[model samples]
Target: MTTPLNCIIVDDEAGAHLVLDHYLKSFSSLTLSASFYNAIEAMEYIHSHPVDLIFLDINMPGVSGMDMLEAMPDPPLVVLTTAYSEYALQSYRYQVVDYLVKPIDLPRFTAAIHKVFRRYRPLTPAQQEGNTAAPPPSSLMLKVDGEVIRVQLDSIMHIQSWGNYVKVYTEQQVYLSPVTTTEIEQKLDKLGFKRIHKSYIISLQHIQKITHGEVHLNSGVILPVGNTYRRDLMEYFR
Candidate 1:
């Protein structure tokens, strides 16, 4: 039997809880362990309970979601849900699995859950029992020069947005695709890529070093880490 992941909701608003509870019912792999209206109570419950995931809200009356994360020496997989988009980059400081804006739809929520699943279960139960080996690396289908092309996730070093188009830097070559950075960010977030700047998204594995506000990729490419995103970028390495 597949082991179900235990999840908890920590949102102050009643409507927020209702929405998440309704959405969660669709996913059988996860079980709702508890719900808390305040960060203090939630923190207390977490101390005594075994929680695998947290659906946290950023704005609360007394204690915020980011505050709770800061207090915990070690935290469970976090998915931040808020009405504001400005908090999106800052929430990554806790290494959250995903940052979801308010009024989240089923499709986006489903994607976030799948990302959590991949992180929680790097190996299947059967693989843990020595039944099979790991799967192959994943790839992304991208439209480049009016043609759809297959790009290996591991081969990508960085991606830079050029107005409506994006330049994907890989080990072999650079592919210019007519896709927005926001669109590609959704696809790459599940993997180990991060949007460290409005115009730049980089593979975490390809980072050689960070110095003075610049990120040096393993391919000898240097990119500026935007001031707004610098905190989250530094938090990633920590």
Candidate 2:
């Protein structure tokens, strides 16, 4: 007999917990290890338990779900559950297994869970010894306003900040988001996106020319490379 996947729910809403609980009861292959209303409590439980999957929420009172995920020593497969769809792109940067919008239907939830299971099947002793492979790169989902947009990493040119919002300039179009520059800076830094200035993070692939302390993008936009970021920018150029 196969072992049931040990799962936990970390959501701030009582209704969300109830909804997930009802759906989980229907799945014979799933076992609820615990449920938490906050990141602190959830962190404590996972440290003591062997959890296989996590149904996490994006926005919480004190510590957000994304924050909690970053703090995990060995993060389990995370499926984000949130009402705010705008955070979809940000969550993808964290390598979350999947993103589920709030008011989740049973069918969709089941399908997502199955996808996770299939994607992360446990390796056998021999396969593990042979060095199990990693999963493929995932396309990021960006929610701008009410629309869901999938942006392939290759199409991205650069990201620029305007006050509280960041505009992602892609080959196809530009996406505006109400997120801080620091937040976008942190997410994109590891994904080959370099901060050339306080206001600009350019995709290293789309940079066409660097001259006079400015970066010329493939799209013909010239962005200033800030003095603070100049040292790293010069190194990347070399």
Candidate 2 residue 106 C-alpha distance from true site, Å: 16
Stretches off by above 4 angstroms in model 1 are: 121-238
Q: Distance (Å) between predicted and true CA of 110, model 1?
A: 0.3
Instruction: Please list the Cα RMSD from the true structure of every candidate, rounded to 1 decimal place.
Output: 16.5, 10.5
Please list all clashing residue pairs in model 1, or write none if there are none. none
* Candidate 2: segments with Cα more than 4 A from true spot: 1-13, 16-121, 125-138
lDDT for each residue of candidate 2 in 93-140, tens digit (9 for 90 to 100): 777888999889998898888788776778688988787564433334
Cα lDDT tens digits for candidate 1, 1-238: 2677899999999999999999999988889999999887686577568899999999987668887787676789999999999998888878999999989999999999988977774456667789455444377766665344568899999999999999999999999987799988987775889998999999999999999999999989999999999999898778
Score candidate 2 by TM-score against the native: 0.55
How many Å off is the CA of 45 in candidate 2? Answer: 17
CA shift at 61, candidate 1, in angstroms? 1.0
> What's the lDDT of the predicted structure labeled candidate 1?
0.86
